[model samples]
Target chain A: MLRNTPIKRKLTVIILLISTAVLLITCAAFFAYDLFTFRQSMVAHLSTLAEMTASTSTAALAFDNPKDAQETLSALKAEQHIVAACLYDKDGKFFAAYPANSPTNNFPTAPEPAGLRFEGSYLVAFQPAMQSGGLQGTLYLKSDMGALYERIRLYSLIVLLVMLGSFIVAYLLSSLLQSQISQPLLQLAETAKAVSERQDYSVRAAKLGRDEFGLLTDAFNNMLEQIHNRDLALQEAQQKLRQHADDLEKRVAERTARLSETIAELEAFSYSISHDMRAPLRAMQGYSDYVMENYGEKIGPEGQQYLQRINRAGMRLDTLIQDILSYSRAARAQMDLHPVDLEKLLDDIIQQYPGFQPPQVEITIEKPLGSVIAHEASLTQVISNLLGNAIKFVQPGQTPRIKIRAEPRGDDLRLWFEDNGIGIASKDLNRIFAIFERVHAERTYEGTGIGLSIVRKAIERMGGQVGVESELGKGSKFWIQIKKS
Target chain B: MAVLGNILNPSKEASNRRFTHRLRACLAGFIFLLLAINAPAQISREYQLKAVFLYNFAQFTEWPPDAFADPQAPLVIGVLGRDPFGAYLDEAVRGEKINGRPLIVQRYSGIQDVQNTHILFISDSESKHLLPILASLQGRSILTVSDMEDFVPRGGMVRFLTTNNKIQLKINVNAVKAARLSISSKILRSAEIFPPAAK
Candidate 1:
């Protein structure tokens, strides 16, 4: 985050310089304090000598005997490193002084400590001798302090020089150390910048030492390694996802092609049954009709009965052919499912059966014949076929009562086509709907036994199930359950 | 003082000429005597010349009245500590004297016995005692000398140094202040003044 800044270098350098300066300043201050105290003490010493001399020699100066005063003054002058001695009375009168060769009372005088500039110069101190003879005199004495100042000043100068020299040395040494530290840090910063801006993890930080900078470089290299690994993982994951999508697309394409082939084969089988079987059935019926019509006048009643058998056989053959056609059409029809009104469908079926007038026809259709997912034409055929079978199989002297009902059963529609008719025998009920099978003699019922079989095939093609429940001489109910896909 | 007067009396031109002629003859005679006493000047010639000059300096000097506590006391030329000249200086000062005092040699390890020493020769190794020795002999008739760089600058009486690879001496005028001893101007002229070299 701080790639563009030289914050590390700045912080390192600033800390080094500040600490070095603080140490140097502290040492210098201590040395200076020592030097100032030594100077102060030296000045105090000189002033003390001056005061002592002034006090001791006040009495000797007051005596006023030139010879005794001169002798006393000479003794004072004998002090080592004394330049000249002067006896001053309490009244500030000069009685005598050593080195009488000079102009009397005209010797050079300094503030207190004399000859501080030159080494080994004299210091003059006055001592006043208080006599018991009521004669107050001053005795002057001189003491040299020039050597003391010289030694102190020399010592202080040496300390000052050493302090300055050490400070410079320390500053230079610290600066060198800071460079050693900061140079690598600066290089590391450059490497980090290059890594981020150029996205080049190959550039590694330069390792400078076995210190903290080297450790930081190791950490940086590790972080780059992790980033590189994650990048590779993401790319691999993306590639895998692409491969999965491609496999799914290919499978869907293959399944759709196989479904198209199955639909074509079903259409071809339906077409062949419709055209080929209908022609042969038509020829059979036509030949039978011609024989019965021409031979009826020439033959007697016995011959006429035989001719009638031929005609009935032909008619049965024709019903079989028609049932086959119906089955083929249901199987091959283009399925278009929509919302179907079963009430409207049943009313139309009843009107189509006007010629086969039974005593009465009672049709009850439940309200809300619900809409469903189905082909409209196929569903219409399903309702019409079941209703026609119910009308045709009515019992003698009994009006047909047909009820059409629909209700939801799970995710499908359960439709019921129930009627009261000559029901099937219990043993033959399972086999009654098979092709070419008759439950009774040919004269008893007029059907090819193909109607229920066709209905089953048609309802089954529409993705529905069909079943019947009945008892002999009682009634039968048929149910069709079609699932909503 | 008399040798300085003879050398610097420029107004006595004819006498000065005669003096120079006689000095040349004396120089020849001294050379002759030096040969008779020892060998001719060869290597270590400076050592030989310095020994002869040291003997001359002792003879020309005059000590104070109380310098010798004993009347028959030797005019001791004490060689304190190491003496680099070996037997050459001993041979040169065999019978030298100043003001009728015989030249005697004394060797001392401490400054306590330095009181009566008229001429004190300090070696380089005994530099630490030079100042104290100077102080002890204050107001006495002692001439101090050493062999070191600028010894007179460090408050010695006379310093012996090597200039141009030749042994030479330096004298400090301020060192003679308390002693009240006047050095011959001829000697002063011959030796280099130490104050200028010190500065």
Candidate 2:
């Protein structure tokens, strides 16, 4: 039982030990006092007996009456403890004796000198039989001392009984009182355990008494209250955080939809205006060409030169309108991505484009390009524009040397287009992908400046990135990053 | 004195007309009595000791200055009537003295002849004469002694008895006082005394 309830056991043991010790000390002292006085009283009795025996036997010994001396000594037999008595004449010889059992064989042949002492279990007293101005003889009395031992035995038994009784009472009282301490302690432990397991800090321990356990219970309840309050506060804060995040996400989605609608409307205006402007421009160009061809001789040299300029100006205006339409279409379009065979695509592009055939300008695939996820049309437009720019911007006497390569970067592919051409300056490099952004003059580049801008928008719509790295007087390397299948 | 000397020694062959004849007859009776006794050797040894004790008492006791006729006079120890001590008492007191005076033993037939006696031993044979003997020694400095029962109560100075195989002494101080005898405390110390107030 003590294994689980050590406090109760300890209290009982402590009480028992204390009571036993007190009982032992008290009983020991009582026994000591009783024994001390018992022995002292025994000595006193023996002394009195010796004195009386000497007084009565004095006359008998002085008279040399052996029978009288023997009778006087025989009187001692009436006393229970007395075992033997004797009288000696003044010469210290054995005069007369009265042994308990007759014949007196155990008596010493000669009398011992006068004294009192203990021998074995007997107390021997030798007193002088004295009279007025005379010492007649010595009287010897031997008394048994077994009575003192019996008294001690009796006292020991009583002490044992007292010890046993007190020990039992202490045990009972200790056991009854120990519950006052152990009950509340057990309740507190169980409460603490339950609170931790369930993470519910509302449980409180029971108070058993107006003592330390009560104080502990109060403190425990206070701590649980604080924890319960803190728990509720933390839960409220978390809920608020979650609600704020959802509200912010909803607002961001609404704003994103509105901005996309506005961008589509603006793109519609630019596309419709470009398409309407295309008709007048085409008509102007065709009529100019007809005038230049049909009435060359009827008009003079100056008139013919003016007709040629007008035809050229009309053709340039048509090109600018076509480039603006493509750029506008690349930005304001839905995206469709697929896994396209880039090697086959590049082969088809080379076949479709006359500028990509070897000799005049060369393009090589440094490594086989893996299939990647891209919008087919946008990927084709982006690659085609980069190849065209590469062939167009070259040194005056040099053939365009362009290289195509694809390499893996994490989960995406970096498709590189390197060219031997005049590189842009560092200050204008970041702006090269902007709408209608150009660094070279129009007449020098012989193309509209919208190519790189269209390449950036098309790649961006396909969820890819476009960038160019160059140093003047060297070459340019342009990369488009698209996700791998 | 001559009768006591004969009583002290059987070989002295005392010339008592009646005593010599009784002595011869008593010698035969004594031999028969010795033969009849259960322990003659021990009884005779004990009586011989009592005889010596009587002589010692006479030696130790003091008497009045004029109890003897002169400084050279003998200290007399008288045995009255039948001499139960036989010749032992005389043999014990022979060649002994008390206070520069020679010792003598006397035999008396009656209380009238107990005069000038320092110690009078009343034998058991004359138990009938104990009263008159005590009366005659009453005012004299004479020590009256006996071996009879209740002798001390009857105003005798000393008495002898045996019990537990040892001789014992009894005394009456009143008798000693009436006789004006001065008994030594050492002698009285070993004697059973009566009339306890006169100790």
Interface RMSD per candidate: 23.4, 11.3
Clashing pairs in 2: A62-B189, A62-B190, A62-B191, A63-B169, A63-B190, A63-B191, A63-B192, A64-B168, A64-B169, B7-B87
TM-score of 1: 0.34
Q: Pick the candidate with the highest lDDT.
A: 2
CAPRI tier of model 1: incorrect
Backbone collisions counted per model: 22, 10
State the weakest 10-residue window (summed lDDT) of model 2 chain A: A100-109
lDDT of 1 by residue, A1-485 (tens): 44555655465456556766776677578657765685566555544654454433332232223444455445545444455666544344455667654454454332233222322354344344432222233444444565555656776677677666765776667666767777877888888899899987667787888788889988887888888788778889999999999998898889888887786576566557655766775776676567668776777778878867876776666666666677767767676666666666656666777632445667777876666676667776667667777776777677888777887899888888778988777898788666567787766657777777777777777777888888877778888888743
* C-alpha RMSD of candidate 1: 24.3
Which stretches in model 2 have alpha-carbon errors above 4 Å? A1-247, A264-354, A360-381, A399-420, A446-468, A482-485, B1-199
User: Residue A312 of candidate 2: its Cα lDDT?
Assistant: 88
Assess chain B of each prediction and give its TM-score: 0.68, 0.75
